[model samples]
Target: METKELLKKVKEIELKTRGLTKQVFSGEYHSAFKGRGMTFSEVKNYQFGDDVRSIDWNVTARFNEPFVKVFEEERELSVFLVLDISGSNNFGTRLKSKKELMLEVAAVLAFSAVANNDKIGAIFTTDQVEKYIPPKKGRSHALMILRELILFKPKHTRTQLDIGLKFFRNIVKKRSICFVISDFYDENDFYDALKIANRKHDMVALRLYDPAEKELPNLGLIKMFDAEQGVVKWVNTGSKKVRDNYTEQYEESQQKLHDIFRRSGVDYASLSTEGKYLMELNKLFLTRSR
Candidate 1:
């Protein structure tokens, strides 16, 4: 992409997503993810209705007056966009590719985090970690993330969400709100890693997919290629047995993903490239609110 074109795309996305954040997601984002914890702000003279447990005994003794330590929730949070950039993301049969949708989703979340005055960062990965943008707060930082998402080219060609989770756990010390945006077609066992990561941080899964991934069109004959592994095969799409087997496999994958998410206790949402992402996001937000 040309520099001028990329700039326009970034500006366009920033305007759209930032506006949505202000209009719909401002309060929901704040409520959905909490801060690290409460921290002491100051000590004030005790008030009648103040919690007795908050009393500052040392301060009270020094001043010979009852004082209470006031603590406030740390409003600033660090949000990590752990994105997958594998070749399978290129196979969307909709308005855009899964890769395109992933970028937009990440951009919206990044803008929302920045709108809430939180630091936003990202990690672009395939089977391995490709890039890491350190957490920072500002429109410039968010734009940088958008630019990276639009132009990033990964050296690897496969998906391993497990590696992404490990990288997140190792680098980030303080608890963060991590969003793993991917199609999640990996065979690697990431359940343990995801469970551990969720224990330490607030982890949410944003699964990007296409409706065709679940159902196949009955074209008489079709040639398919593995996007990541680069293998090609011709299939008799009209055959009932073949269609049934494909449908069974797709259903199993969906069920396993749901079970993994449920067992991990991580909040999750899915975005289909053929569907309205805004509606999906709004539904997820409303569901979370409930």
Candidate 2:
């Protein structure tokens, strides 16, 4: 894209996502992902409904009156967006590509972090770690990230999600809320790495997919391309056996992905390129909040 066009896109995304963050996601996000813990704020005179356990003995003794320690939730946090920029995300059969949907979802998350006054960062990966943007706070920083997401290109076309997870584990020592955004299309096993990463940080998987991937339509014979492999083949979409096999393979992969998330104790939600992603996100947030 040209500079002017890119800037226009970034600004548009910022406006839409920032508005959504303010109007819909801010409070839900805050409730879903809390800070580390409570910290002492001040000591005040005890009240009838106050918790007796919070009474400060030192302050009470000093003033010869009942005083209670007040504590406030530490609201500051670091949020990381781990993105998959592999070739497969560029495929979508509906209104937009999976990559486009991923970009919008990422923008929403980054804005949500900004609304919460948390530092936001991103790691781009495509079978390898492509780039790492350090966590920072401010609208400018978020816009910079959006720009990168729009213009950045990857050297590799394959997917190895473990590389991204391991890179995050090494660089970000502080515990953070990490959102791994991808289609989870990989031939390698990343379960161990994902589990280890979640051990130190809260990990959430936002899987973006296309409906065509899950079901094959009766479009007769068609040419199918494997984005990651950079290969093409003719597929007989009208054959019932062929369509059934395709659906079965997709289901098996999805089942395996779900099993990994469940066994690793990581939260995840799958969104389709043609469906309402906002609703799915809202459901995920509500589930986490509870």
Candidate 3:
């Protein structure tokens, strides 16, 4: 993308996301992810209802009046947007492709994090670590992340969920809210890595999928290609058996993904490319808040 066009896109995304964050998501987001813990913020005159244990004896002695230590939740957070830029993400049968939805989803979360005064970072992967933008707190930094998510070209075309998660675990030592945005299309079972990453970070799975991915229509003869694997095959989609098998396979994968997340004690939700991502995300946020 050209410099001018990229800036325009960044600004456009920023306006929409920032407004939404300020309007709707900020509070939900704040309540959803918790802070590290409470920290002493300041000292104030003691109040009648104040906790007796919170009395600041030194401040009281210095001021010759009762003072109390004030504390607030250390609400700042490091939010990691782990995104998949694999070729398979390019497939969608709706108004927006999986990749497009992924970008928008990342942008919303980025803005929400910024609204809460959190540092946000991004990791773009496609079978390997394509890019890692370290966490930074600022509107400009968030916009830069949105820019990269829009235009980043991956070095590889395959999807390796485990490799990306392992890389994230190694780089981000502190606990963070990690949003793994992918279709969960990897062939390899990444349960071990998922568990390890979850232990280190508050990992959540945002599974993006296209309706077509789950079921095949009765289009007689079709040539299908695996964008990630670079494999091509002809399929008789008109055959009921073939369609049934395809649907079953996709469902099986979905169930397995859900099971893995459940077993690993990770929070996860699914969003279809044809569906409203914001609605699904809002539901997840509310669910987490409760």
Scored by TM-score, the top model is 1
lDDT digits (tens) for residues 1-290 of candidate 1? 99999999989888877887787786888877778689989999998999999999999999999999988998889999999999899988889899989877887888888788899999988899999999999889999999998888888889999998999999999989999998999988899999999999999998898988887789989899998897898999999899999999999998999999999999899998975887778777777766
TM-score of each: 0.91, 0.90, 0.88
What's the residue-level lDDT of 85 in candidate 3?
93
Against the reference, the lDDT scores of all candidates come to: 0.89, 0.93, 0.89
Best by lDDT: 2
lDDT of 3 at 28: 91
Model 3 clashes, total count: 0
Q: Which segments of candidate 1 are over 4 A away from where they belong?
A: 42-69
**Candidate 2 vs. true structure, TM-score:** 0.90
| lDDT against true structure, model 1 | 0.89
